[model samples]
Target: MSDWLSDQAGYVWLIIAALLAICELLIPGVYLTFIALGAAATGILALVFPELGAIGQFISFAAWSTVAVVVGKRWYGANPVPSADPDLNNRAARMIGQSVTVVEPISGGTGRVRVGDGEWPAEGPDLAAGDKARIVAVRGGVVVVEAVKAIEADLPDQPRDDQTQSKG
Candidate 1:
């Protein structure tokens, strides 16, 4: 048994690498693949130097695996994957720069504004009903708004005196 184990040193590392790769699939931290790479590297080294001592192999595996995990973490972290919805977590950020109507009068910079089907608490200068305000920012679950100039309605030509007179 001892002689067989000694003759199959390279196989031991290859098996270790295969096991680690499997473990990586079960794990969530995304760390085991680096160790598996190091183990595979050590296995290749063992195949190259059949006369190398077991202690030397163990030390090489330890050092290589540690470096692989550390360096891999650093390199992977340097580049981040761009998410599809980066603002998904920040609900208030989506409301910034939108326009909302004041459903309730704003007194002392506090009021309620209607945006779509939802009414959100707002903070801004005093505004009355039907006032138009532009969302500027969000603070403490409240939408901050600034006054926006209201667009004037288009008017046609003035009617004549007879047209303005009441019908009999």
Candidate 2:
């Protein structure tokens, strides 16, 4: 068995590498990729030095696998491929940084806000109806907001005794 393994170490390593590569595809964590690289390196080394024994080839494979894992972690960890839209799974989380209107008065940091046609529960500083607010963050089903501007307060004064403005 030892003689056969010593003779076929290179071919065995190559096959192991191919299997690892397939496993990496089946489970996509990019972890098996490093071991696959190591196996390929060992296969090449065995092909170059066919006189090396099976035990020596196994030792070389272990060393190569360790180095590959460390290097792969550093290179891939430092620069990862970011998703195009990270918050695509959560619609509420994606709504941060948007301007919304205070649909109901905010008191004790809880109220309702309107973003486009939808209304949502919000928590933030106290604000009256018609106040412009900005969505800062989302907490579970509620959004955290801050008063941006009081649109009605910023408007110019108008006459209150107009005929069309009388209440029934």
Candidate 3:
């Protein structure tokens, strides 16, 4: 068994590389993949230089592993994966631009406002309870809001004095 393994050292290195690659897939993080590259490189070197002994194979594997890790770091730094939804995890940030009702009168720059089914701490102009406000920003856990301008068209028509009087 010893003589056979010594003769087929190159195949053993290749098998090690395959196992490392599988482990990389199971626990991802561009780390094990780099080590696998080193093993595969050592296997190829062993196959080409059949006279190279165990010590030479170990040195080659170490050198190749260092080189692979350095190159991988630079590659990832230059090309960062951009997220499709930048605020996917930020619940408060996602609420920006949404309209919320002032559940508690906002005074002294802080109060509570209805955000969806929950009430969140808010900071904005003085607003009475039930006044509509628009979320402008989020500072810490508090939401910053601005009073939503009232649209006159939405107001109920009030009769003028002349219109209220009976026509003679």
Query: If scored against the real structure, what TM-score would every candidate get?
Result: 0.71, 0.68, 0.81
Rank order (by lDDT, best first): 3, 2, 1
Give candidate 1 misplaced runs (Cα > 4 Å). 114-119, 130-132, 148-168
Each prediction's Cα RMSD? 5.8, 7.9, 5.1
Q: Point to the candidate with the largest lDDT.
A: 3
**lDDT score, candidate 3:** 0.95
How well does candidate 2 score on lDDT at residue 136?
93
Better of 1 and 2 by lDDT: 2
Q: Which should have the higher TM-score, number 2 or number 3?
A: 3
lDDT per residue for candidate 1 within 1-168, as digits (tens), equals 987886788889989999999999998977899999889888888888987679988988998899998999898899777889988998788888888899999999899999879999999999997899999999888899999986888889899999999999
| Candidate 2, lDDT over the whole model | 0.91
lDDT for every model?
0.89, 0.91, 0.95
Q: Per-residue CA lDDT of candidate 2, range 15-80, in tens?
A: 999999999999969999999999999999998999877788889999999999999999988999
